[model samples]
Target: MTIAGSDSGGGAGIQADLKTFSALGCYGASVITALTAQNTRTVTMIEPASPAMIAAQMAAVFDDLDIRAVKLGMLGDARAIATVAEGLRGRDLPLVLDPVMVAKSGDTLLPDDAIATLRDLLLPRATLLTPNLPEAARLLDTTPATTEAQMAEQGAALRALGPRAVLMKGGHAAGPVCTDLLVTAAGITRLTAPRLPTRNTHGTGCTLSAAIAAGLARGLDLPEAVALAHGYLQRAIAAADGLRVGSGHGPVHHFHAVWPHV
Candidate 1:
């Protein structure tokens, strides 16, 4: 299940999550916490769902389907975060929490005050937290990371926030290679891939976390799931330019290697 916002562009948020789940052979379900009138270029407007509506959607899923894992994306505000936390409290499902704060087009996806609620109410319940450089920085109230060493430090700090592990994404890093750091109680490991040159990276974070959720649903361990998801994201970025969806930043091809590339 993916608890996220809706992207009318179908590039990121719940749209990307469902595509990723299907590509990875996992059945997908969703609870939309907000709705955005957005395209690949920009988010024109955002309207949050009522807490009651969000709860209803979650109950509609948990009450029926035997969901294996959950991927959380853009919760619009504090009430939405509280609603989801309350609905998911005490459930032991593997949760891939992608701290989605802003969009690629520089639009705010999550409201400011809700950050505190996410930290207090949602972080502890997460099995794994995936935050990019900026999101990690904002969550910790520090400067964003720009190097592998810095990312490792940030990953460790994020793990201390109560998630079993934290995956600090390095897409914002300046380099020929992008490195993602996974910090767990077990240890820190680096996953690197040559950077693909493309502006069509609109939905990468959402896709990667959703892929991880799909992998967990299929019974892979966290490390294995993350590794596979990383590989998938790389190919999706590589194939992104071929897709001419929008005028500005386009979306990565979630189905690029659906038959298996790595």
Candidate 2:
């Protein structure tokens, strides 16, 4: 299940997550914490759901569905964070937390004050914490890592903050190859892929994390899920140019594997 926000443009947030879950052969449930009037070009407005409504949505899903794993994204504020934390407390399920702080268009999705609330309430409960360079830096209150060594260090640091594991994404780093480090207490697994040049990468982060959650829901271990999700995202980015979704940074092709390229 995905507990996140709604993107009216249908490229990121809950929309991308649901698409990824379906593409990876998993049934998805959602609890929307916020809504954004957004497109590929920009986010013009954001409206957060009331805490009661958020909790009600969560209750409805957790009540009936046989949910296996959960992916979290784009939680707007402290209230929403606390609500979700309480809702999932002691559920004993695998939780994938995507620390979504910014959009592809450079818009801020999460405020600075709410970071503390999220770290306090949700970080310790997460089975896997997924964060890009900027989001990681924001969480740690440090500069973004520019080297693999630094990424490993930061990943270890984040894992120490109570998450069982951390996946430090290297997409923001400059290079021809994008490297992601899966940091666990046991060791670090380095995943590298050739960076495809494409601007249609709007929902890459959401898609990757959701795919990992789908794998986890299907009983794959953390390392296996991360590997499959990484490869899937790489292919999606490679096929992104085949789509013409918007004028700005468009979305990755979530159905790239299933849809015939025109």
Candidate 3:
């Protein structure tokens, strides 16, 4: 289940999550929390669906589907977060939270007040929390410097926030190699890949988290699942670099290696 908002551009929010799930060979389901008039260039406007509507959608999905894992992306406000949290109570399922606070175009997807709600309620319930550099900094209330040590330290701090594991993504940092550190009470595992120079990075975070959810649904452990998901996203990004879809920063091709249409 992908509980998030709709991206009209079909890049970043629920759209990207669903594509990633399908690409990884998992049945995808969604419970939309909001809708945004967004493209590769910018988010023009946001229309948050009522909390009751969001809850109803989740209930409907839970009632019908045998959902194994849930990938949560953008929840616009505190109420939306609360609604999802309330709906998820007592379910023993893998919940992957991609703390999508800011978009690639620098728009704030989650409100300031909603951050607290996310930390208080959602983080504790999540099986794994994936946060990029900025999101990790916000969650830890510290500036993340460009260093591997700092990344691991921050990842550890994020893990202490109640999630079973925390993946601190290093894509936002200044570096030649991008590293994502997975921290848990057990230990830290680092997954490194060469950062491809490309503009088609619109849905990277969503794709990574969704891929991890797919892996979890397929019964992989936290460390193994995150490693495979990171590798998959790296190849997807490299293959999608030059394929232009929209005017501005475009999306990574979800079906980069699938097949040519008939």
- Over 4 Å off, model 3: 260-262
Task: Spell out the clash pairs found in candidate 1.
Answer: none
TM-score, model 1 to reference: 0.97
Regarding lDDT, does 1 or 2 come out ahead? Answer: 2
- TM-score: model 2 vs. ground truth: 0.99
Residues 78-126 of candidate 3 have per-residue lDDT tens digits of 9999999999999999999999988888888988888999999999999
Q: Show pairs that collide, candidate 3.
A: none
Give the TM-scores of the predictions, in the order they appear: 0.97, 0.99, 0.97
- In terms of lDDT, which candidate is strongest? 2
- Which of the two candidates, 1 or 3, achieves a greater lDDT against the reference? 1
Worst 10 residues of 3 by lDDT: 253-262
